[model samples]
Target chain A: MDRIPILKIGAALLVTIQVDLHDSVAMALEEDLSNMIVKAGAKGVLIDISALEIVDSFIGRMLANIAGVARMLDADTVVVGMRPAVAITLVELGLSLPGVKTALNAERGMALIQRRVAESGLEADHAAGEF
Target chain B: MRIRQIVRAAALEAGLSLVDQTKIITAASELARNTLDHGGGGHASIERLQEGGRRGVRIVFEDTGPGIPDVDAALRPGFTTGRGMGLGLSGARQLSNEFSIATEVGRGTRVTIARWK
Candidate 1:
């Protein structure tokens, strides 16, 4: 029943996935992120997966699902810090993560979210401060 | 998660490269989930393989639930009977160096995959 913590920064939500998540834990994360976006009026979501060693089909689908739900809730989701090996395996696993936006690191991910927020005219002044 | 750790250790012990280790571990995860969700719970076996001078790791997932009726269709990408994205079986096959599947409609399913170092 462990839940991944969601931190709110400016108008965005940040999640650092440091564990090789169990299926139920991943599901709970998706649900928790959805609720946090609505409750905090978050315009962007940043998920850091650099620490995770692997992403199977289940985790890949979870990322896509999070992006889909965020889009539906009027928010953008950016996944960052994927290791090279993990990226190669993900693509080989037949998942391109069609709808999820990715960044090489957290700085770029925050920038992508901020740019989108600025373009969308949704609280453009809120800066994504240092993590 | 225990399965993942076990697979990783086995792959490392078998002298698989980092990328190779990652591939086999991911494949084991996908197949294990299929065994649990689609096959109604099962077991996994890990083996260290040595042939001539080459080393490898092999994983086998077995289940007694309703087996896949059409393995060809099941192995095809983007095919699913459940809520999954339909990449588990096909993806697992692609990740491993050797793959084999045996299933009977009313009996059970067994998927064996191996990766060489």
Candidate 2:
């Protein structure tokens, strides 16, 4: 079975989607990510999708779903490396990806996630509870 | 599956912007899925073309299933006969430079879309 690897980097969980994901794979990712965030007690999540060739509405929805679940689990998600064409296409697809945060690249995304975590007092909550 | 791969390769080979390549590939994915789930499985074709000195790519998807009974409604966003967000058709049109669809009630459906460089 094809599986997207999840790497634990200090206080954050980084997921680099490097393959063309089947719909089933995408769903599996959503479930896996949600579980990882809780098990790892991660404060931030950085999803690198620069290698993705497509962000069709389905994929677009999956991204939003991840962001939503991550937030509920007390993890900040910063999606990075979105190609401009994918951005334009997503809007055209009527998906503004509300509630999802985005960054230009992995570095920027990591920084953004950290900054968001700091601003929202996420780190303190991590000690107070399993985030 | 194979159709999406072909479309992705063709879109990239056209030297389109990374974003544009993604857009076409996304559109291809949605349309191809529609062909399979709704059209009961079919075939799709792609063409790299140069018309009026402008280079572009075209993707055509055909399926012989229960054709759409109301195309006008289907073209509108959020109108789906199947379980979907109803953004596939409308979203594809938004991503392409040109979009057209033809279907017969008892026959099949054909959708063509092209993006220029």
Report iRMS values in order.
Answer: 0.8, 1.6
Clashes found in each candidate (C-alpha, N, C closer than 3 A): 0, 1
Q: For model 1, which pairs clash?
A: none
Per-candidate TM vs. native?
Answer: 0.94, 0.85
lDDT of 2 by residue, A1-131 (tens): 68788987656789998877787898888899899998978877888988876777677777878889998998888889987777777877787877788889988877776676677776675445433
lDDT of 1 at A18: 93
Reference contacts preserved by each model: 0.86, 0.77
DockQ agreement of candidate 1 with the native complex: 0.86
lDDT of 1 by residue, A5-123 (tens): 99998778999999878778989999999999999888889999999899988888899999999999998999999999999998898899978999999889988987887787865
Show model 1 residue runs off by greater than 4 Å: A124-131
lDDT of 2 by residue, B40-95 (tens): 98878899977687777899999998889999898898888876677888888888
| TM-score of candidate 2's A chain against the true A chain | 0.85
